[model samples]
Target: MKNNVKLARIKANLTQQQLADGVGITRQTISLIEKGKYNPSLKLCLQICYRVNAQLDEIFWISEEEFNSEENN
Candidate 1:
């Protein structure tokens, strides 16, 4: 999956460490999330959404491929 976490984080003037600390995760985890190498749980997602002041759809956008795959299931 892809996300705009990095962009939003940057726009929010938050470093990876800052966001991770606020969200109670590791900086590496935040980095991984930005890189799209890790999938955050719903709890973590909510934390990020609130901290960044961004909507779920804005940051963790659902790709067309993922949406179609979900429909298939």
Candidate 2:
């Protein structure tokens, strides 16, 4: 899935490590999430949203095609 985690992080003036620290996750995990290499659990996702002061959809919303494909899995 695609996300705007990096964008929100930048808009919040947070480095990846800083955001990770705020959310209690590893910096690598935040990097992976931004790169779309990992999908965070809902709890973790909510943490990120809260840290970045972003609405869930603003950061973690996926494209319709991606969402549809996931439904097929």
Candidate 3:
């Protein structure tokens, strides 16, 4: 899944550590999420969305290419 987590965090004026603290995760987890290397649980996604002032779709929507790739896989 692709996400705009880093962009949202920047727009919300939050550091990775601060967002992680607010969402009860570690900074590295936030980094991983931003890098699209980690897929957060729905609960965690909600928490991050709330903290970053982004809607779920805004933060974690899958692109058409990714969706197609997943289907192929």
Candidate 4:
């Protein structure tokens, strides 16, 4: 999945560690999520969105190409 987590974090003026602390996750996990290498659970996603002051869709949006690729896979 693709996400604008890093962008939102920057916009919110939060470092990875700060965001992780707010969401009760590790900095590595936040890094992984920002890189789209990790898929957070719904609860975690909600927590992150809240911390970043962004809606879920705004942070984690699926592009048409990604959706198609996932379907194919």
Cα lDDT of candidate 2 equals: 0.91
lDDT of 4 by residue, 1-73 (tens): 6789999999999999999999998999999999888899999999999998999999888889987896676
Candidate 1 residue pairs in backbone clash: none
* Model 4 clashing residue pairs (backbone): none
- The candidate that wins on lDDT is 4
lDDT for each residue of candidate 1 in 1-73, tens digit (9 for 90 to 100) = 5789999999899999999999999999999999878899988998998999999889997879886785676
Q: Candidate 2 residues 7-70, lDDT tens each?
A: 9999999999999999898999999999888999999999999998999998888788998887
Residue-level lDDT of model 3, residues 1-73, one tens digit each, is 5689999999999999999999988999999989877889999999999998889998888889887886676
lDDT of each: 0.89, 0.91, 0.90, 0.92
TM-score of each: 0.85, 0.87, 0.87, 0.89
For residue 2, give model 4's deviation from the true position in Å: 1.2
- TM-score (C-alpha, index-matched) for candidate 3: 0.87
Sliding window of 10 residues with minimal summed lDDT for model 2: 64-73
Clashing pairs in 3: none
Candidate 1 segments whose C-alpha is farther than 4 A from its true place: 66-73
Deviating ranges (above 4 Å) for candidate 3 = 70-73
